[model samples]
Target: MGQVITFGEVLMRISPRGKKKFIQSNVVEFFFGGTELNVGVSIANFGGNVKHIGVVSEDFIGDTAISYINKFGVDTSSIGRSKRPLGVYFFEVGAVMRPSTISYNRSHSSFSEIKPDMVNWDEALIDGEWLHWTGITPALSQGSFDVLKEGLQKAREKGLTVSADPTYRRGLWQYGKDPKEALSELLHYSTIFIGGINEINEILGTEYSYSNEDFIRASKQLMQAFPSIEKVFDKIRTSLNSSWHKIRARMWNGKKFHETKDLDITHIVDRVGTGDAFAAGLIYGLRRFDDCKAMEFGSAACALKHTYEGDVNLTTVSEVTTILEGDISGRLNR
Candidate 1:
């Protein structure tokens, strides 16, 4: 398998310790994560070859971020540095019934300063077999959108599989570009769609409900509109509250629909990056397993991510496999 190429911003996540509110905490914790970076790190942790391309502040903070990514064995050679500060978000981890809150301070960050010419996509994607991108990149700025589009185009030319996770954020599209237009354009280059009904409805400007029947209908319509999308994989989450959730995945791969059983997560250590984990697992599994097994792998990985605290999923491949093999007993290793 060739390297998995991930392109997006590198963000520093700052959060109050545990379930305490910002006003109640005197101490905080920080982690290095971004949607694409989290997926890259999780893939690397699973012993996959992965490379990340992004810009960070040309300061100690950026240095530390690079080091943190390097610690996960992710190739960061394509990453650049800028005078602007690294993007940061303050998160307050919430418990049952209460929801989590996040505030972004990334408007003028180093990643938003990215330009098309800043990266040599041909060189960055030379050894890449899969390229993953999210809606967050293009939502930041015109420069970021142009840069991502350039990379996607190059990946297409190189015959690499492009995975699109249209993680649309209504508040992030303040750059005047139509969200539907931008995402629809990128979808033309993507082969796999790693999103659900909400994303499809957002991009296609259709109102689709959350039913499985609607999902199949929406997915069929999506493929009809964008024939390049060969397969659609969705991770469905049922949140009983902030602490307890159930995850299951379903896929429409042109000819058939496959679904997985619900994986219950009774105590979520953290909710962030669980979707990215699903994407990573699906990417990894597709290389080795069939479509149904891949969806099962993704759903299991997503459930396991809630057991770890941070924006990145650190669970190993064996651990995820253990869960997939029906071993959710939380047994001791010793």
Candidate 2:
């Protein structure tokens, strides 16, 4: 199998412990996480050769982030150092009837300060067969968008299959350009895309009515607009509460639509990296399984992530396979 490459920031995530509000908590826990970095870690945990490329400050927080990435068996040799501060976020976990909240302290961080010339794309993509990135990266700053665009161009040139999570965050795109325009350029180079119905309408200018036909229509329109696109997919989440959610996934693989079983995920330990888990699982499955099986595997992997308490899904392929094979029995294994 070919190696996977991802480019984005690695942030230090701080959250209160055991249902404690940020204001009330006396103790806090920290974890290393970011969209692309989370995916790289998940892929590595699944026994895939993966590399995480990004900029980090020459501080202890940056050192911890790089060490965390390496601990997961992800290659961090391409991680560059900067003088800027490392990015960090404060997360407040919510209980029933209340929603979780996140406040970013990521502005001016080393990764957001990245320049287009900092990375040698040729060297990064040398042994890479797949390249992954998220829309969140470009939303940070103008310089970040430029580097992301340049990376996409180089990844294309190297014949690396590109997958992107079109994660639209309104707060981060303060660089004075419409997100639709910036994301359109990146989407043009992506072969596999992951997003929701609302994101489709917002970014691709397609009217999604939550119907099966409209999904197929929108998927076809998206592929037509960007000829390089081969597949578009999404994991639909139905939140019963902050602690419980039912997740079902679907994919439009150019010719047809495929949907997976709905998984009722309860007592979610940490919901932050579930989407990245699905993305990683989908890419992993695409390398081995058919579209239907791939979607199922991805959905199963994400469901398993709810049991873990960090940003990265530490679950192995065999664990996910057990869930995929309808063994959600939490019984102890000998």
Give each model's whole-structure lDDT: 0.95, 0.88
Output the TM-score of candidate 2: 0.98
Error of 2 at 284 (Å): 0.5
> Residue by residue across 31-106, what tens digits does model 1's lDDT show?
9999999999999999999999999999999999999999999999999999999999999998999999999999
Tens digits of per-residue lDDT for model 2 on 1-334? Answer: 7779999998988998977887797899998899998898998989999998899999887888888888988988889999999999999888776888889999889998898888888888888999998989989988888988988998898889999888998888887978999998899899998886877788777678888788888888888888998998889999989998999999899877888888988787789899999999999999889988988888998998888887889989999999987888889999
Lowest summed lDDT window (length 10), candidate 1: 294-303
Residue ranges of candidate 1 with Cα displaced over 4 Å: none
Q: TM-scores of the models, in the given order? A: 0.99, 0.98
Cα lDDT, model 1, residue 71 = 97
Top-scoring candidate (TM-score): 1
